[model samples]
Each structure stands twice: as structure tokens, then as C-alpha cells.
Target: DIQKKKQGTFLPKEARIQPAAFSMAQVAKKPLPKAPAVSIQEEEEEEFKISTGMEPGKTYTGQKLDLDLQDIDLDNVFRLIAEVSNLNIIVSEKVKGKVTMRLKEVPWDQALDLILSTHKLGMIQQGNVVRIAPLKDLLDEEKERKRVKQERLQAKIEAAKRLQEAEIEAQERERKLRPFVTEFITLNYTKAKDFQAQIKDILTKEPKLERVGTAVVDERTNTVTITDYPEKIERIKQYKEKVDKPTPQVLIEARIVKATKNFARELGVQWGAQYAEYDKRGEWAWGVSSATGSGTTPPVTPSSWQSGSFTQGTGRDFFPLSGWMVNLPATLLPTPPGIGLQVGRLVGDLINLDLRLSAAEREGLTKIISRPKVMTLDNVEATIKQGREIPFTQVNPEGNVSVVYKEASLKTTVTPQISPDGRVRLKLDVTDDFPDRSNANPITGNPEIVKRQGTTEVLVRDGETVVIGGVLEETRATAEDGVPWLKDLPGLNWFFERKTRRHDQTELLIFVTPFIVQQD
Candidate 1:
């Protein structure tokens, strides 16, 4: 290993460990890299995600609209950048009344920035997604963004450290050199020595190239390919610095000191904690989702729930909610993998779900039944971009046919459950079978989802009424066609008593969030 040089002693200039001509005056410590004036947290905040309204591959004109909105009211206008020429503005001039405005200009990006900056009151930040809403939403986003300001600061610090390292490395290789060249390349690399020998051989064969350039480095895979050239080089073209080339001997035998507690704490088990912003759909609600359809919407519902057969002591509802609802299989697993032995604590973190303010359905109308967690992202696809070529001998029949079975998946379709986030989420999962649902449609890859659902039918009420063609004969009241039948039962919510279970049994509760039904 290349040991760092150790200091002999702190003495007079003459007693120092250096050439006799060396003096302390030549080295009054270069100010410690400006102690990064930035505070640790502040350093992190500097790592901002950069984006621009200015677009490339576009033509510009003198008549450009610069969208610069500096101050804005939250509940008034919905600003939308629809196109390069038109800005679609949905404005709520009055309560529940909306008017769409399409403002046009040549340089749309300029117009957009100008308008935005002009009305720029502030911005709202959440998670990594920031909502540039008016004062209220912007304030909320800022509160959330700043809530984790400490974290943001730390992230900035780490990013700055990385940048500093990169810049330093870049500056180090700024020596007087020539551009090393390697012409006519081929993969013939072996050991470094052998590679060097090969380079020499190549140079001996072709004299036009320059002195063996710094081994053509591939940082992507920390490996270097020796190159042969005639002259020396200045700086690496795009790559400004030469990677530190450790000797092979050093690599053969290296010692790794055990990581310290502080180090471990810095990069420890990174867990994902799922939680929505500190608010619900009180005035402005939002959510998005999708549901898989099945059984052709119950063949148009030929009949309704008939309790008249109670006299026969047999049928009425198929099986409570099971006949219809069927415990809508989650976007993921059915019972959500239990949180005990069988499930990994990190698994649920990947696709976390929660419903802080439960779904509200007041009237009998089914539309208010389940307000879905909006803007759902479902992966229903599998694709093999690289196809394997099947090699075969001449003797086999049907052997030459390369079987390329395309990936198929369940077409999990979702409706456009609009929300402030502008993503689709809420889903009405209509199905028939309880346990074995979605059928054997092996959802292998990205399944094609239908958004505007018009297939499923919501059967409210339908019954058989036998009548003599337009002749209305007086029928007995409270009787089912001369057959005595029990009266329709009133609906009720029967409470199922709860019972405690042993610690061994699972008790993981899932939170289903209503992330869709929000204010526009």
C-alpha cells in the first residue's frame, strides 16, 4: 500500500525534513479549503433539482409570452402549461363554475416563466414532488419541505462533498501533457503487464500514434485498458482527470479497517416511512386509483335481491357482501402479506398504503361508497427487449422455430379520479368470484389498462313483474302474486364483537388512503 508520508518533527527551517533550500515561508498553510462557509444543513439544501421551462428543439420568435406569476390565490385559477403555443388555464370564476382559458404566444416558455414569476407568491413542496400552487398550497408545500429541512440540509452536505471530490480530482490531472491516442481498438486485454506488452507490440507495429497514453480508463467498471501511442497527452478529453492508478501489488494485499459507529450511523439501515401530508380532504380533497374488472359486469344483472322466497326457507342474498363486493383484492396481494414471520418488514415499505381520514359515504348512493387513494401506479407489464436467438442442428423438425412467447398481464384498468396532484387514482373494483378472482389471466408484464370505463353496470333495482298484456287486475297488497311472503328487511350494520389473539397471531392493520377525491 502507498503509505502517506509521515512528518519527522516540527522544528526550525534548517532542521525540517526537506531539501536544504526548503523554508516555512514557502508554506504558510493554504487556508483550510474555506471551511465550506455553508452550515452542514445549509450545504445539503443546495442540492436542488434543476428544471427549466425553456425547451429545446424549438424555434423562437419575438412575440413570446413569459409566464411569471409572483403572487397567486389558491382557489382561483388552475394554471396549466398545455402546449408550446397555448397555456390552458382553468379558472374558477365562481364556486363550482369553471372556465377554460387558452392563452397563446410564440415563445411559450418565456411567457410561462414571466407569468409564473409575476404571480410568484411562493411554492409548495412535498416529498420530492413540489406543487407550485397559490399561497395556501405553496405554504403547505413549503411547510412540508422545510419540515425535513434538516434532512434536506444533510443531503446537500453529502452532495457538496461529492462535488468537491470530483472537482479536486478534476484539478489534479491538469498537468502539462499531450492527448494520448489509441487507434484501431480490439478486445485483447489480459493482465496489466500482458496488456502493456500488447500495447508495446501495437506501437511497434504502428508508429503514428503518440506515447502510451494513460491507460484508457473505464470508470464505469473500475478497469483500465493499456493503450499504445507515440507522444504524451495533456488532459483527458471529456474526463478531465486521470483515475488514481494503484499498483497491482497494492491491490493484491489491502487491509480494511472496521467501520466506526459514527460511519455506520451515517449510512445505516434506510427504512421507508409512509405518511401523507398533515391534512385531509376537508375542503380540498384528492385521490387516484384503478380496479380490475371481471365476469362481464354480472351479465347485465338479470334479477335483484328477492326476499319473497323466505317462505321457502332458502334464497335471498347470495352470501352477504361476498356475493358482490368480494373483498376487492388489493392493488398488491390479497390479505397484504401478514407482518409477522412470513413477511419482511421492508416489503410493505415498497408499496405502502394508508387512509388517515376514513372514506365517507353518507347517503344510500353507492357513488360515495369508497373514495379511492388516487394517483395509483400499478406495474402490469413484462417485456424482453433482447430476444435470445435459438441455435439448432439440422436434424430436428420444429427445432429451428425460436419460441418467443410475449409477456401478458391482467388488464388492471383505472378511472380518471382527478385530484390536485393531477394524477388519476380512485378505482371501482367490480368483480364476481371471491377467492379465485381476476381469472387465470397471468399478469406477467405491463398490462394494457382501459381508463374511461363504460363496461361495468351498477344495478340499483330490477325485478320480474308478470302482468296480463296491458290488463291491470287488482292484486292483493303485501302479497307476492297470491303467495304469502315476508316483508323486505331493513338494512343494518351488525357489529362483530372483537376478541384478542395471542402475540403469535398476526395483527397488521393496513391503512387505505383516499388520495383522489380532493379539491381542484
Candidate 2:
């Protein structure tokens, strides 16, 4: 049993946990990796120092370079050279492309040249620093600078040539014109030597002859020698003919006239009464008259004694009892004025009074007639002058070219005829463009252009006025004297509004006057 108990103790939890702990300690007892004999980074740093031969914070002299780099960047090779020589070398962005070079025991500059030349790069040595640039870019920049210099030199040469040509032209002109000044012309005149003095005096007054030179006339030979330009010499030859001709002058006048008129009317309805009687001559009294008062006889009725005659206080000083038969209240009855009396026969209780005022009114007529205004037509200056002819060019149409004379759009011509008696006639022909609506195209809705031509001819003397046009009629109506909100009411607004209608006749008269201008 004891032997069984010993085997049981070996099968318990402690025996199982002890074997796991022993295996974990055996795994934890493993040995770490061995340390290196010599430091690789230190060896590399030492080799780098030997290869570069450079110290920090010290000026650098170039050292020998031995490099064997393949398919490396150009900037990387430049960095290697900068370390070896301890020199400040900057690479520009333009220094690009890969490099593959092999060199042995060469100077740093020579070694740098081999690496950079393969990639077409060049360095600029500026004091202690070097700058890298592409060789192609430098060559192109130099070529462009030379081209610009050549262009400037060529421009200067052309300017000098132009100046020399102008000087030669002036000298040639002076040489050709020198001979004409000394030439003389002989003239045979029937008049005395006084005629030679007259010719000399005329040439002196002429500015063109005096500008180039002057004239010398000899009375003994009766010969004239004029020192002037060739064009002036031609005018001198024709001086005798021009003096014999007479100059003509004329005077012209033009006048411009305008009229305006106003008319007003009042429309209303009134209820009133009037009476009239027949006279002794069987003729009716002229107009209706109003009844005065109780003691007075009615002015419109005939008297009792005269039978048919109407009398005003004739032998009847006192009012008869018959005159007081129909009494009317003095305060309630209204009397119409004499100016408001109707002219025709009156019959109804409400008589329509037709008022008429003649044009021979003597008072208060200024309101009906417009005030007169004085206007002067001196603002526009005359464009057509006595001796000047002005030419005007017309603009071309949108889609047409006027190459042929017959196919031209319009032609206007003006001709002025002047007489010696101060009578002037203006002949004007105006061709206007009009749309041809009668022959409009049905599909395109386009109308052809038609030319309507008219001619105007008028004759007038100097300082005379001419008038054209008559009265024109126009009507204007406006709703005035009413409240805005009440006038717009649907049906009951007519009482709140009063409309004013004006009939106007306006006459615009154009007065044109022409005056003669004297020239010196």
C-alpha cells in the first residue's frame, strides 16, 4: 500500500506543475548573440575622413578624387566632390540626368568635369563657391545675346543711310531750282515805261513770288526778269490776261415764319325762364327780359293802354293793379345778366343761351391769343460759301456694295444761280429712301427700297424773308379738379370729376433769309 501511495503522490497536481516550471526555466536560459569585434560605423567614419581629408570649420583645398559610380544621380556626384574638396558647390535645378563615370587618382576638378560633362553640365567658379548649370542653356543664352547686339548695330546703320539720303535729296532740289531765278523774258508793250512799273508793283504784292525771290524789271529793254519758283513764273506769264477780266458778284437773302392759337369751351345745364312780346309794328321785341319787382312793370310785357306796343314808364308812372296780378317772391327769383341773354326767339321755360363773341373784341382778349415772341435765326452759320466747294462721302449699306454708277443708292445735287442784280436761285434735288410696301415679299417679310426724288426751286433777293406752312389742329383732353380715389370709382365717380378738353391749332412757319458776304 505504501508503494501504491508513493505512485499516487507522483500523479498529484504539484508533480505536474513542477515539470512545467522546469521546462520554462530551461527555455529562459538561452544565450544572447555575441558582440562584434570592431564597430563597422566607426570604421566607415574613419574611412570617410581619410578619403575626404577635410575638417569642419576650416577652409578647403581641393584633394584627389577616385570614384567609380554607375547610373547615379548628377547631384549625388556633386555632393561627393563637395565633401572630398571641402568646397561649397551648389547644384542648380537645371543640372539633371544620371551619370556613369570611372576615374582614378585624378584631381577633384578633373574628376568633377568627367562626371558633369557626361550629363552636359558646367560649373561657374565664384570665389569659394561653384554653381552648376546646363551647358546647352549657357550656349543658347550666349547665342541670343550676340543676335540682339547684331540687330541693334543693323538698325543704326539703316538710320544713318536714311539721313544721308534725305540730305542728298535737298541738295539736288536746290541745284535744279537755281537756274530759273536768273532767267529773263522780253515783252513788247504798246504802253509807255509806266507799264513796267505796274508789273513790278504787282509782283511785289504777291507773297508766292517774294518767298523764293523777287522780280527785276528794266524800263529801257521793256524786259521783265522774275526770280521765283517755277509755279509762280507761270502765274506771272498770265498776269496780263487776268487783269483784263472782270469779277462778278451777287447778293442773296432767305427768310423763316411761325403761328399758334388756343380755344376753350365750358359745357353745363341750367333751368331758367324768360318772356318776350310783339310790338306795335308787328315785330317781336329783340330779346327776353326779366321781371323787376312789385311796384315796377314787367319789362318783357306790353302796357295796357298801348295795346300791342311795349313801353317803359310811358304815361303810366304808377304800377296798375293788373301788373300786380301775378306776384313773384323777390328773394326767391333770380335774374340773368344782359351779357347772358339769348339772341333768338325764346319759347320754352328753359331757354338755351347761345353766346357769340366776335374777333373785334376790345378788352380781355390777351388770354385767348398767345403772346408774341421775337426769334432771330442767327444761330446756324452758312456751310455753302461763295468760293469753296465741300465734298461729302456717303456710308455704304449693310449688305450692298455700290460699284456701278447706275446701281447707286441715292444721288443729291445742288446748283446755285446768282445774278448781278442781287437775285439768287437755289436749285435742290433730294433723293430720299422709301420702303416699297406695295411689293413686299410674302415669305421673307422684307420690303425693297425705293428712291423718291423731289426738286425745290426758289428765287429771292438779298435780306428778304419767305414763309411756308399753315395752321395745324390738335386736341387734348384731361380729367381735372377731382379726387384721385373718387375719380377711379366704378359708376358714381362722374359727379366727383370734371374733364377739361382743349382744342388747339398750331401753325409753324419757317422763314429763311440769305445774306451776301463780302470777301477781301
Model 1: residues with Cα > 4 Å off, grouped in runs: 1-221, 226-234, 241-406, 410-520
Q: What do the candidate models score in CA lDDT, each in turn?
A: 0.27, 0.40
* TM-score (C-alpha, index-matched) for candidate 2: 0.23
**Model 2: per-residue Cα lDDT over 357-434, one tens digit each:** 122123332122211222222222222211112222233657543332223132233344554555444443433343
Worst 10 residues of 2 by lDDT: 337-346
lDDT, model 1, position 212? 31
- Model 1 agreement with the true structure over 346-382: per-residue lDDT tens digits: 1122122111111111221111112222233222111
Quick one: RMSD of model 2? Answer: 38.5
Worst 10 residues of 1 by lDDT: 464-473
RMSD of each: 41.5, 38.5
